[model samples]
Target: MTRSARRTRRTRRMLSVAGLGTAALLTLSACGSSDSDSDSGNDSGSASSSASADQKLTGKVTVFAAASLKESFTTLGKEFEKAHPGTEVTFNFGGSDSLAAGITGGAPADVFAAASPKTMKTVTDAGDASGDPVTFVRNQLEIATLPGNPDKVASLKDLTTNSDLKVVLCDKTVPCGGAAQKALDAGKLKLTPVSYEQDVKSALTKVELKEADAAVVYKTDVKAAGDKVEGVDFPESADAINDYPIALLKDAPNTAAAKAFIDLVRSDDGQKVLTAAGFRKP
Candidate 1:
């Protein structure tokens, strides 16, 4: 073949190859755009689900409650469940501060029933609660010791007088401990506890276990303990009372059930159960 003929044919082949390369680039660019659209659609779906979770109020109701309310609240919670057929009431009982932390850490909770208004204020301050809180019940402190009262803790003054006895108390952060401190301070008495319990239940349990001679725990807790420990009521205790407060959260998932439970607690019937367990009227 002639030289010019061969050169022309080679030039045409090179141009055809370039054209194919341009076509492949356009095809890849189109696929990339399609994938981008798919990702956007998936993100939209995920966002829709999250919005539904925030806007709808039907599922489970979570309550972060004080540890001392374990039994009475448990019974009350069961009643709440029975009253609302489609709803379930779940409880996370612990120290009020610990429960506050759990709720603040993104735990899915619907209500908070604290042993004190101070702890309930923690939630309101954080803008977690929905409305003005009301006191549901009041509880008083008492000295709980192993059955038979071997140490003879008949009076609050005796705690300071009897230095030999080992005593335990709920930490100052807890409602019961705060009440105990107030009662002691009012009496112008200063006594040291061997251990500062994290919660009232733990403080009462220490006495029940015979690990400590006595502990100032809630009267409701003493009644709940039932024979494991003997309760000693001193005169000064009449002055210091722990007020319990409860409310539905602003971000509640089951507001209907949460409000229902709150209503039940405020009802005449609910007050009966609480008063029966030694809680004072609000």
Candidate 2:
């Protein structure tokens, strides 16, 4: 019953306590390692998801664009199709108002490029647009005369007041027509047109076919017409430059392709095509 017996028992108790402490520490370390592995797995999944989100886009993208954009947008559409193989770009080019109506009426379209913000709003207000429309270009009014400008049309007033000349104008609901009206108002002049067309292309056609002497239209249209019609810039047109806006529709069948097309329209290459078509930067 002695010092040796007490010391051996005390030493045994200390060893047992240290063994339990070491076991507890190992258990906590195992749990921490498990949690770390779980966290690492979650991060990997997230990274994979992010990578998948950027997968290659392939589909048909239908675009409802203003009639004036037919030439330039057609060029862009071809470029888009080329850039994204296996993708097709289809366009519905008409009056901005008509195009807006189509989009709001449940016509399945991926993109909308209006000649003016007002037309774009018609789609946005109806919750048809996926996001705010961005203005990519601006267009000013000009007089589209016959090839060689035989009438010697000098200004907007010449088209407005020269009763001897049969002139065509776009409908008031059309962007080009509205801008022409604004320009006319700015000049404080008024004259009835021989005919009001549904779109800029139609109005320009009247001049191109010699159906009318001159037509008020976008400079881009005149430029697109090439030798088919001569363009005459007027000072009053500066006051009525229209801002062209583009947006992806909310119910777009091809959101990815639609967004990519919008990005292209805003890109430098797209701007170059537009500027070359005689459209000004927005």
Best by lDDT: 2
lDDT of 1 by residue, 160-271 (tens): 8998999998899888888899999889999899999889999988988889999998889999999999999987887788889998888988776687678778888888
TM-score of each: 0.78, 0.81
Please give, for residues 66-176, the per-residue lDDT of candidate 2 as tens digits. Answer: 999999999999999898888999999999999999989999999999999999999999999987899999999989999999989998888766779999999999999
Query: Weakest 10 consecutive residues, lDDT, candidate 2?
Result: 45-54
Using TM-score, give the best candidate's number: 2
Q: How far is candidate 1 from the true structure (C-alpha RMSD, Å)?
A: 15.1
State candidate 2's TM-score. 0.81
